[model samples]
Target: MTEMNYRTALVTGASSGLGRGLALWFGKKGVKVYAAARRRPQLEALAREARASGANIEPVELDVSEAETTLERIRELDDACGGLDLVVANAGVGGMTDGRNFPWEHAKKVIDVNVTGAVATLSAVLPRMVERNRGHLVGVSSLASCRGLPQNAAYSASKAFLNTFLESLRVDLHGTQVRVTCIKPGFVKTEMTANIQHMMPFLLEAEPAVEFMARAIVRGEDEYGFPWPMDRAVGLAKFVPNVLFDAVASKVVL
Candidate 1:
């Protein structure tokens, strides 16, 4: 774990859900936070709230799915902050349909926003961090990344990519001051999961979940999986036979 105060942090998808929570928390910690999301009104409201708390929070309009726009915005944010100390690629979408039944456009959209966006964000900052030899990168994965699940194949696979990518990044940055952490949370009560119709195990509210994630980032953990029960569940799932896993997962609602 690295022990240095971060003066600036950038969080994507910060208009709502876990991103918003992280932005608020970081701002409260007196870190200059650049909060980005596509929706202007929502982001503006978030900025207002953060300002009310006497924290430096800059709201930026960004759609992670748009690579050029996102990259440009990253450059702008970097210039504004002089240098970024923390980067949290937290923008993602959940697809409700099975892979076969899923619309191809939806799959593309999910991957574009979740996997490619994360890579782009990392690419924008990694070089600078390497040169400075200091910073932390946090990618928000999910428990679904640990194994294939039913109904949400796109979402699950996207997270799996993040898990592997972040792990590889951590390895690449080994011995350097740069730290990469993959946060795999179980079912969290956020707008994204509000319409989900399945039984969610070890469900946690957004605030607590964000707090846990922030602590993990600050500690420079290699990986952070939440809710002891779900962590064990995922661990066991990894050992289960594929046939059995498929059979069991078939019954789970997305």
Candidate 2:
């Protein structure tokens, strides 16, 4: 993988899954990483592993769902570090929602972590990065955003919201040294997706998935969705007639 120009990074949800992988990847590249997650023990373990490998990683105990705390903690880190060159809002939650009798609490949790949390993460550092005229901001969206999936109303909608938000952010920051990237990934094996019993198309292991995302961020792509086959499949789904799409999507077991 090509080395990232960023010297310091902050990755939310860094205790496990793609977040953990990305943090390790960045640390291996000699970037000072602030790995944030609500799980203190996991974060500490990750830090130990990274450090043993000669990587500079600091564990940050953070719960992104609490907006105020998230902002305060991230701000403190940014201040302490002088500034963070890259900030990835990788924190997210996923679950199936029942539409028959809407699961408001479940939906709320999904939106809270996946949508609001991501926005809060980016909002915390955006101004400082703009003032310094350099930094990269990235969000982990999903291919589910291409079209709503069965029993995944909240999760899909949350990612859809993120996709548009990142797109607008990218356009608004155009011509500036600050860059925004939205990465829509297909199913990647992780704790979040471990309960999924359906056959996931083009499923990628977390390590390779993180590698793909890291490359995209380093290249500063405005938006990237993969793996290619799954991305193309979802892109084509966008062109399907609504009624037909709904019929097929509604039957999906995931």
Candidate 3:
């Protein structure tokens, strides 16, 4: 679809990281952005930048885990915009965990943000998109979903859930005009990975990464994974024998 096709878009997690990058790109492209995030100041900053770009932007207060209220607020924003043509369920958390440090709350919070939050965000907008029969839905999965990493039990699992969810939705919505796309990025330099202690090969900066994703989104791809090398490596991991993979993965310090 053309850039002009999307008059209104709602981007969750727009306060920082990939979400912010996507929001900025969307605004730059002249889409009215419903920027959803938990931080008022950051969202305000986004609104200011959008204004400078002569873009229409509304910084909607959102904590994606707050499923009920988040949907309500998003619905209100959609109503104000008259309609929403694109919805990016990008809010997620990568709560670190270790064998000894694993806690129910920590893992739960990660799942709540990465999985349930996407569900809630999609749940809120999908019906409207289906009803209108013209729109795009984006879920940001990760290359981590291709395999289970030792250090990222919750984080990897959550992303795998995202990949699965979006693909399932794509099949379910096959004949509809509504489009569903799942983007899996290997490593994009963002606040989330700023302090990551392991090697992140082929990590793209946020802007370029979002730009690539935007192109895919515009084309309405079913699923796209990028930074080719990492995508290939991760995709290949799915076919590796479990025992051999576990033996090698055990050596991964991070």
The full ranking of all candidates by lDDT, starting with the best, is 2, 3, 1
lDDT per residue as tens, model 2, 74-107: 9999999999999999999998896877889989
Better of 1 and 2 by lDDT: 2
Give all TM-scores, in the order shown.
0.96, 0.97, 0.97
Q: For all candidates, what are the clash counts?
A: 0, 0, 0
Better of 1 and 3 by TM-score: 3
For residues 115-145, what per-residue lDDT tens digits would candidate 1 score against the true structure?
Answer: 9998888778788889999888899999888
Clashes of 3: 0
**When superposed on Cα atoms, how far off is each prediction in RMSD?**
1.4, 1.3, 1.1
By lDDT, the best candidate is 2
TM-score of structure candidate 3: 0.97
- Colliding residue pairs in candidate 2: none
Give the Cα error of residue 237 in candidate 1, in Å.
Answer: 0.2
Give the residue spans of candidate 1 off by over 4 A: 1-4
The true-versus-predicted C-alpha distance at residue 162 of model 3, in Å, is 0.8
